[model samples]
Target: MTARVLLVTSEAVPLVKTGGLADVITALAQALRQQGVDATVMMPGYPAAIENACNLKQAGNLPELPGGPGTILHGVMPGSDVPVVLLKTERFDQRTANPYVDENGAEFDDNALCFGSLAHAAVSICAGETDLPVPHVVHANDWHAGLVPALLRMKGITGVGTLLTIHNLAFQGNFAMSAAADLAIPDSMLTPDQFEFWGKMSFLKAGILYADRISTVSRSYANEILTPRFGHGFDGLLGARREALVAIPNGVDTGAWDPASDRLTVRHFSLNDMRGKSGCKRDLQQLFGLPVDPFAPVLAIGSRITHQKMADVAIDALPGVLERFPRAQLIVLGRGDHAYEQAFLGMAERFPGRVAIHIGYDERRAHALHAGADMLLHGTRFEPFGLTPLYSMRYGTIPIASRVGGMIDSIVDAGLQGTIPDDASGILFDGEQAQDMVAAISRAFELYARPNEWHLMQRNAMSADFSWSGPAEQYIGVYREIAPVEAQALFDERSAAVNDSVNLPADEEAAEAAAMPEYMTA
Candidate 1:
């Protein structure tokens, strides 16, 4: 029988997005539904997330929320077979654009409470406490919905297993324990085995401790999180669940990401018709205001400018890279840490015409940049599963990335090893040092200097299958394996309570961040 899965995420496609998490949620939900694995996507009504809502239904109402009484808003996904729910609170109003924000462009302190409530609503749906159907399983994505696994268990609901997918371990949400009551979770549940983290309430820990099974975005990431280096202070906790941890590398929706079919790119090309790719290079150059020279190697980046992304390595190697390859040009997209922003802006100013910077997220520009660039830059400190590298490969762009997490998994196409195989995608830098990056880029540069060699690498990248079908199937296996008849009644009861909650929309912030597409960043 098909597993009825309730997928909970902070963001999803066509509604809102700020990173690969949303894409993963959208892809998995759609793919599962296609496979007859019934699925629904529950997301916060963050302003950007609700912008595309075609219609809404009052799911039900909740008596008291963290801020006050709240209402539940439900809407169906545009083209997919998934239902999305938005939690609106009477006191604070639900966020309309940014899920994590207030009027002054700052994150709300009640973010934990806000998102926690949304998770409760999903659980309520599963327990049949709401008007919606009781799901066989609740699939929680990332740290945002980490509270789901624990909240369901806290309500004494069982049988409907909770599968928590950790996209990135570095983002665990740890807040004051005082918020536990607001979350409708008892202080006793905050013990070391539960949601506690050194006297703080940890949402991520809640998932780790309570979920029936734990999964990460990549196998390497799942293994990495067991060590002190990648565990983010939760290695011990993860060690406890050593037997329960699983790795399912994320996959892209091939149809949406295909270079041959994507109209956003300047040139439409496949492995056989690569000549059109040069047009993309010219388009990229033109868009970035750089010299449109087919001979120059265009190095591109489309990620948040943060230390986590190892963007500093790119900044540090800029002078050397420019001196070594005079024809080299860089175009960066996305926003992040203030320090990195200042540094990138300074570099752009210092090297006019050679460096182009777009400070915020723009999905179309990101797609164009991925298609047009000759080589992609992904020097991250650590990655759960870097989706951009896969996106680049799909567009026939060779990648130069750090050997970590999903970057390693996605960049290295299986069975093509050593001696620049015809299917060799890109160069891998092992260390975080600037010299290492400079050397790797230098190697890519050497390859770029040779037209035939560069074309072979591009072909290698394009042939990879980063599609969601396989991963979706894997998720289905995990969902079914963990689902049992025992949890059915509990799930139904919880669903009803959640459906009975309130949802209030947040007022438009006067100083909201630029309303560019939020999906393609980070």
Candidate 2:
């Protein structure tokens, strides 16, 4: 029997996005379609999502949903033929700033109920209560859709495999135990071993305990979340269910990101012919009111200015980078954490034309920033997968990033131990200190001065295959594992496929370091 999967997410590209998760979901669904898996994305009907989706129509309704009532609208995702199902209700329609956050940058007060409605809606599709495909697998992404597996179990639904993909373990959808009854989660399932996390009910924890299998964005991150330093607080629980864990690395949305064809970039460029790059660089400089100098190194930083992204550390080290590389120019895009925003604003004022900062996220600027920059500064305390770095690499822009999580897998650090110079794609530093960041930035400038080596590195980065084809196939394997296929054709046909998704628990030393946290919601 052919495999059918329902991909439950909070966002997607061209419709809405807060980060890389949207791009990953869109790419995965498109790739899965190419490989014969009947993948359908289910997300909330934010105003943009509804407007961007093609051929939209009412699919069904969930009247007594967690948040009162919700209508499931079926349509094709923006810019793709992959089927999309969106939850339409007042809970999602009223708030427009961020899907999960309000205008004040605070997470939606009723997020538990909001996403709870999303999870319940997925169950409606799976249980054949709606006029949609009865999926063989329900693949829930991040903490937002974390309750899918638990809701399936609670409703006594069988023959449906559940897979939870942890995009970022830190943002676990944790809320008060008092709210458990509202979502219909039972007290028996709210114990420490189940969904209870530090006297709270964690949506992520519920999925980890009940899902047929669990997956993270990358192999390195899969292992990282198994420890205390990176686990946030769920490492011990994840370790206990270690046998169910797997790693599927995220892939780039090559169609939207390629510099040669991207509609957002000022000038198109390719690996063989990089002549247009200077024009794009000039446009970038002029866009920020800086001198249009072709010789100056333009370093781009595009990410949310949050503690997890080392925004605090960047505030301290960026001034030193400006002083050390007087001719270098910096362009930053993304918004988060007010203090860091103010700090960058102050730095821009002090440096005048040399430093420029864009306070919020914009698709056009994001594409231009990568296409024009010589190098990208991406220092994350922990990364599920380095989508920004990978996107920059596709544009022939090298990255100076932290040596953690997915960055370890994606970036080939120059002059670092266990790395070959000819294959080095970017610069990587291990420490979190400002000095370490400056050291990495310093090394990038040194590499930039050598034209031949820098060009070679850029070519290597541009040529690297970060597509979704490989990872999507691995996801198919995951679906086939617990899915009740009527025929043996799936196994017989895919016998040649590599079976490398397994990730056994790390040793005791690694397990001791496992932990999780709730940064939002009390």
Candidate 3:
């Protein structure tokens, strides 16, 4: 039988969004439902999200959240079939405008407690202690919902299974142990290796160790995380659970992200009626105030300005890029660190119409940029299955990216593979060097100069599929494997293994360890 799944994540579409996590959650949830799987998405209601997407209707109150009680509000957002549950904490969550942010634009310290509360609420629903609907599987995304699997196992919820997915391991919520009492988590869970990493409580580790099954976003990333270099220091923990871990790549929403039907794009065009795309290019150039050079190559970028995205590569290579192609232009969007902001703004000043930088996110502009640009640049230092490149592909823009992680799996390298075919989708550089980026850009420009070759690449990109249907089906398969009948035995086996590994000889040591901050190095 198809299982009823509870999709848990810190962010969801039509609500709180900072990255690809939101897109993954909403797309997968709806896709699962369409395939006859019953799924509900639970997300925190940030002000922006509530204003933009929430259609609120009462789904009853949750009186037993950790630290105190909470009122559970429910609703449906645009483009999702899953029900959204919002947890409003009287002392913590209610005061904040965003789930992950405070007034100072800093990440709230109470993230552990906030998400732990989300897990606790799921447990309550699982135990039939509340009137909310019980899902057969609790699917937790990233570190935010990491505690769900552990909490469910601790409570011995008989019929519910937990599946923890790691979207990005880098942001594992490592919070202070002083707030342990307020978190209301059991004392037995504290340790140097389980929930404790050094002296900090790692929410990611907890999910990895305790969940019935663990999954990463991409197949290559799953292999990547098993080593010291990519594991983010949790390789040993993940190594132990290798048998339980699965790697399933994410997919994009074809309709929403596609240039063919996207309302946000300045001009819509498909593979057949390709002439309109040139119009889109002209419109986008005019909008961004770049020189209207129809022959000049346009490299579009819409990403957070951070090391993870390799903004440094773009900054360092600007001079060489300008030297190589005098007419080529670069359009950048999104915001992050101050260093990247200053670098891009400085370049725009130095190179006027050739380089345009938009300080923050503008979804409408992003759509137009994707449709209009000749190439999409994604030189990420390290990425966990970036969605922008996939969007660019659907928009018929060739992608030039660093060949690492998901980029390796997605984009084909023209250098190693030799001359790109008429049906080539993109070019992948093998390293982080600016020379590598410049060389790749040079090849792209060469192709751009030849309209015939460039159109072939565009057709190749447009022919590629980015639909969420495939990934959703794979996720449903994972959920079915952990249905109630299989979940009980899995939970018991997991509990015994953990208990064996972390055998506590005395109650005093456990109590002291629990009381001491988890992040404190021994």
Candidate 4:
């Protein structure tokens, strides 16, 4: 009696990844399976996915989509028990290094059609037109799978609930209205209320309009999207569906991210032991070619270099910070925005040995940064639910983050609160200005000078739980709310069994926390 869910997404970790969406989809699917929900992920068969998948077999063949016929392949996600259905078609098979963008950094010309084919396949499977098992709910993630809900409704399909989760509202899949026929979108459903957004066909608007329930990665983001600032031009439509919207914050995989067992880092350390961290710190300095000063705080930035991430602010503040603390070293890893890249490279030139910048992302180095750095610098103007700060905290690294989105939800600002309590996890600045960042870095330096206070905050961060167990349970509650009566009974039975098996200390608290972050509650 398991409530089967078809998780429609563009990417999954270990198979394909360009951003946090891949990690979120894979982890959520795996966690849902652990809780007795039959969650299966459905994604386009990019060459990387097909190359890396395990136990791959032909599930079935799909009817001709706008692109062409596709062969559905079933496989288990590498290193996890979660089942994955890959839609293999020439449209997806020929994708460049990045799924959405090509070598020239331009989006693929047929991206709308390529992702539309993915949505069509998902809707077909949910309607029991494929060899795959019919899902009780079709949960679509982001714009790539956004067309599923609208297509289902347009085709008059029923009995399956649709849930659309907006990971980031900034990247709406908007295409030329003339390409509607190429995407196989019906003319009847092209009105402003459905898929049309300012004379363009929008895949994201379709999902938001037709899905039974809408959710965002964090509670603050869900509330933020109701206004013009965060809504990305869909505030009015989102406001109309306010009652249907829910905010379920994403969670980290404790087993995969555990500092003790992580194979990516040079040295593994836990909360109890303090010796290994120093070893890691030295190793990180050597890796980045920075002067090995154990006393000099190492600040790391592991995010995309983009305007949204406020990388410009960090760039502008670095000179003042280095001047204030002569021995401070900064290490940056990520690639985005050519302007930011040039700016960071210029900063590295200005302060050789003190600043190390890597233009592209390296997973091992990111893990090392989290494990070895004394502090993580996350200065974002807007973030949906950042996984970097969560990873940093788990590695016992204090985060100096902007007070926005998930950063506000997870990090208790020691600087703002004026006390280093047991729960004080990081330093939070109020704005994206360079001066604000300077003040936050200064506060970080102040806390670093007080070893006892700094250690307390690190312990608080390490002790805090940000695992998938909490978020999975909240998702189950959403499933129960939208699922049929029989499915609800099944969910109740599974919830009891899961609770009995997992011995979770904060299951009840997590369930309550899903409604709203504790800080927001009156």
- Mark the 10 consecutive residues where model 2 has the least summed lDDT: 513-522
Off by over 4 Å in 3: 52-55, 91-98, 102-105, 416-418, 486-522
- For candidate 3, what is the TM-score? 0.89
Candidate 4 least-lDDT 10 residues:
495-504
Per-residue lDDT over 253-293 for candidate 2, one digit per residue giving the tens place of the 0 to 100 score? 88899989999988999999998888889988988788999
On a 0 to 1 TM-score scale, where does candidate 1 land against the true structure? 0.89
Q: Give candidate 2's whole-model lDDT.
A: 0.86
lDDT of every predicted structure (CA atoms): 0.77, 0.86, 0.76, 0.85
Over 484-503, each residue of candidate 1 has an lDDT whose tens digit, in order, gives 85543322232222110011
Q: In model 2, where do residues sit more than 4 Å from their true spots? A: 416-420, 487-492, 495-499, 502-522
lDDT string, candidate 3, 222-278, tens digits: 766765767889878887897788777888888688767888877788888887788
Q: In candidate 4, what are the lDDT values of residues 375-423, reduced to their tens digit? A: 9999987788889999999988999997777777889889753567667
Pick by lDDT: 1 or 4, better one: 4
TM-score of each: 0.89, 0.95, 0.89, 0.93
Clash count, one per candidate? 40, 12, 5, 0
Residue pairs clashing in model 3 are 199-518, 199-519, 199-520, 200-518, 200-519
